[model samples]
Target: MGKKFLKSDEEVVDPKATLEVSCKPKCVRQLKEYQACTKRIEGDESGHKHCTGQYFDYWHCIDKCTEVQMQSAACSIHCICGFSFALYSLYCMFLLIWSMERSDEEVVDPKATMEVYCKPKCVRQLKDYQACTRRIEGDESGSKHCTGQYFDYWQCIDKCVAPKLFEKLK
Candidate 1:
């Protein structure tokens, strides 16, 4: 999909540069500390000394800033019933809204429901398949099978159920 599914179709972005630019102002002190630590570690050929602490402090600052921005941008929409989903996860919020103004009914399994409803309509095909099975039972030669009749029965039920199932789901 090579960037086709991205929210933007513009030129490729340098994420590190973007993060640095956005985080530099609020995290300048930590950034300077990290830079200084790097300079100090430059002569350590054994590679035991590191700047992990200062790097994490800088990232913590960026995370705090990003969290505030995400919160501000995320729940800007005020619900008509005067409730806000600022505290809830996005998935729970979606489920709450999607079920609103709809029936308070039990959940259903569409395939099983369609199968029960379609069984009566496909009785003829089922009977035919059963007879084919009986015929195959008498044959010592394993040349005959009830596959055709079984498929016919399945096709009959599917023809009746597929369109209705799609409609109900929609």
Candidate 2:
């Protein structure tokens, strides 16, 4: 008998070709619906016909993306937006505007926000900063790089968290 090749239902269906393969199907649907809503918001004549009170859901989608973007940025040095890093950039822009729009009393500094968002990473950076300072001053006492040691606080912190701080600095 000749060998037979069999294809599973998923392979036949090719969900990757469609928009239905994600674990978060609801989020995917929300993104599509929100894009449709935005077309109407842009005053597109064709879009207005399908958009009735759906605009509110559009805003909710934006809010959701922002939350996910911030979360992904915090947890992983890489963004969860995946190949669509631009969406994450949009999320950062939205965050910047949202933070600025708040009143002075409500506004939180970036350090406080960073501490909350990326606590472990931030604390590690702080420790690195301290260590770097000891090295720059040539203090061998309790220094890990102990043997005629000198440290640069600026260099260590800057080196450890340069990429992270670059985002905020910009």
Candidate 3:
């Protein structure tokens, strides 16, 4: 008999089917292996002499081809460093000038240098004490220094050489 194709309502089907298939297993393993190997390859090889030589040679070629690019730019690293240093120097100079301009007399310290400077009004006020004493003595002796205009500072007769200037005005 010859093989005959049939159209039927019910077709041959497996009720309890057990099939095993491995598709592209070698490809999956190769992808994982390649990923693992290439992951650290760049970092590990970057420090190597051969890789650094190649890198430096590549940069050197690029630098030679673009000579102007390799030259100092307006915002180059060296220019920035030099500009910052100059700015710092100028700031320090300005600070020194400002400090020098400020007066040093206001600083508070007990151990600092002490010097005597004359003030005229304080000296005149101190001399008034002697004048008051002379006036008091001459008034008793009826001398010309006693014009009787002074009433002996409220008539208590206190000595001017002593500490008490006069009784408090009430």
Best candidate, TM-score-wise? 1
lDDT score of residue 30 within candidate 2: 53
Clashing pairs in 2: 135-150, 135-151, 136-150, 136-151, 136-152
| Decreasing TM-score order of the candidates | 1, 2, 3
lDDT of 3 by residue, 18-50 (tens): 110111231343345445545534343223212
Let me know the TM-score candidate 3 reaches against the reference structure. Answer: 0.15
Q: Please count the clashing residue pairs in each candidate, in the order shown.
A: 0, 5, 0
lDDT of 2 by residue, 57-167 (tens): 544544544544444434343333343677766776565555445412222345434434454544645566656545544332322332222134333434555466668
lDDT of 2 at 62: 44
Over 1-170, each residue of candidate 1 has an lDDT whose tens digit, in order, gives 43446566577876545654665677777799999979865755544456887899788767765554444334333332345555554654564455442312333457757999999999999999989877755555445666689789989999999999889875
Question: Which segments of model 2 are wrong by more than 4 Å?
Answer: 1-3, 6-11, 15-19, 26-36, 46-170
What is the Cα-based lDDT of residue 32 in candidate 3? 54
Off by over 4 Å in 1: 1-107
lDDT of 3: 0.36
